[model samples]
Target: MPLHKVININSSTTIFLWKITESFEDLFDEVQLKDINLIRLNTMKSELHQRGFLSVRKLLSHCGYTDFDLIYDQSGKPYLEDGKHISISHSHEFSTIVLSDQNIGIDLELVKEKVLRIAPRFMDISHLDNLSEQDQMKKATIIWGIKEAVFKLKNEVGISFTDHIFEDPFLLSDKKGTAKLRFNEGVEQFTIVFEEIENYMLVCALKDE
Candidate 1:
């Protein structure tokens, strides 16, 4: 599929989403992968994961970048050669990338009832009260994405989503919220914005400045 959407979060930040509808062979033939990445792709055990990985390269190409322009740190966080901060995420059929002058993280997740079942393990369950079953799942997914995004932004060791991250109360109608990470003997706040795309929830997080 072509580019699904582009979200300009601010003058300096943007999000690009791609809905994967092509075959692995097609995507594989289209992208120019670095040698190491080519080996990595061939070693992937799942075809779905391989497709997701290539779809991200497609998105990079859309943004005037290639696999050669991307690199990962020892912590596994991705970086662009041009000095722009970037975050990448993909779930099922959707993949997304966020670019900003400041550090940022983005998450794309499929909405599933399983999140509600395990909410207590990672988030405050009370926030799900008084909401319908569907909204409960949606909210839990958003909160999970928030934690993942913050973790990606920090890229630090010893951060536990259940123990160190907390989300403030926010209604589903708000489409945005705030969270905090109490780690490394200090507390840092983050601003998050989320939207529903098809059956997935896409969330982007950045440190509060």
Candidate 2:
């Protein structure tokens, strides 16, 4: 499955992972080509599996974050040097990272048939029944991304996606909505936004706590 190419919103902090639709390799200067080393490439491949991480780095530079002051924490969780809350996610053909003053999580998924194969694993029975035939594939992808984002936000809180499924009904409308994500502890609320980008779907979760 592939993501449709479209910019959804004006995120104060966002990094869209373009599918390298055409290998804009020509966009780079000769100097950049010379700097490519096997070691650097391997690190990114391991961290992001050779998807769109290089583009993410380019966007980060454009966003004025040149420090590259990020590191994996003791729990193997990734964080930033300036103490800014951070979240990173990459799947299949795309990868995106978001840095924000507030805790944030983002996920992008290709809206396709593969979701049907794995639908039972992540989505509960009720969610599947709620989908309409017209955009069921697109709607299904949204739920997956939403749960992934919620898990990223609460990983520190020690909850898994299976138990802490989003309580609010899945809203696949173009507009955004708020939802409750919880497992055992008090409910943790998040603002959920679903955006249709090309053929892919993205769901972002920003926690207010």
Candidate 3:
């Protein structure tokens, strides 16, 4: 994977993702953030490969001309002081950020067989038992991608998957699906399209009237 991209799938909305496929070493060399941002290696979530991710974020903050300290709401939503709506996602070898005027959420996942084992809990039986031979790993990733996006948009801890699931037409076997989301009587709720890049899946959720 090479880190050289800023593909704009939808330019009108400024909904684009910066994907860096190179090693974190390359990312470190490309962007400098070691000065203002400190990695609290002593105390932080284990999920982070270490405090290295914070530095990556600091690099993004620098690009956005933002000062660092982002606070997380009880719902686990990360907030930026500037009013620029944003969403970010990173996987084993990829990192992405989605920018928009409206509230936005993003998710990235490395396709794996484990996703199939866990689909039943979040997905209805229709998602599982109904798949034809046409439904392949790539196809299943589409549903997971959209659902992941919705989860980011909602950002509420207790929001049940059953209540928040999309009800529009789902994609047939081996195809990607799109839908306009309606979540918890909210304002300007939306469901953006999902796209595949490299070996990862990306979902973008936005709120714009």
Which tens-of-lDDT digit does each residue in 1-209 have in candidate 1?
89999999989999999999999999999999999999999999999899999999999999999999999999999999999999999999999999999999999999998998899899989999999999999999999999999999999999999999889999989989999999888999999999999999999998998
TM-scores, in order shown?
A: 0.99, 0.74, 0.70
Segments of candidate 2 deviating more than 4 angstroms = 1-40, 43-48, 92-94, 130-134
Q: In candidate 2, how many Å is residue 202 off?
A: 1.3
The order of the candidates by TM-score, greatest first, is 1, 2, 3
Worst 10-residue lDDT window for candidate 1 reads: 116-125
Candidate 3 ranges beyond 4 A from true positions: 1-3, 9-12, 15-48, 51-55, 58-62, 66-71, 125-135, 172-189
Q: Residue 158 in model 1: shift from native, Å?
A: 0.2
Q: How do the residues 1-209 of candidate 2 rate in per-residue lDDT, one tens digit apiece?
A: 13324343345545455454334343232113213333455556343354354554454454445325556565656677777766766565565666667777788787888887776777764766756764777767887788888877767666656666663665566547666776666787888777776677777788766
> For candidate 3, what is the TM-score?
0.70
Query: Cα lDDT of all candidates, in order?
Result: 0.95, 0.62, 0.56
What TM-score does prediction 2 earn?
Answer: 0.74
Itemize residue pairs with steric clashes in candidate 2.
Answer: 4-198, 4-199, 4-200
RMSD of 1: 0.7
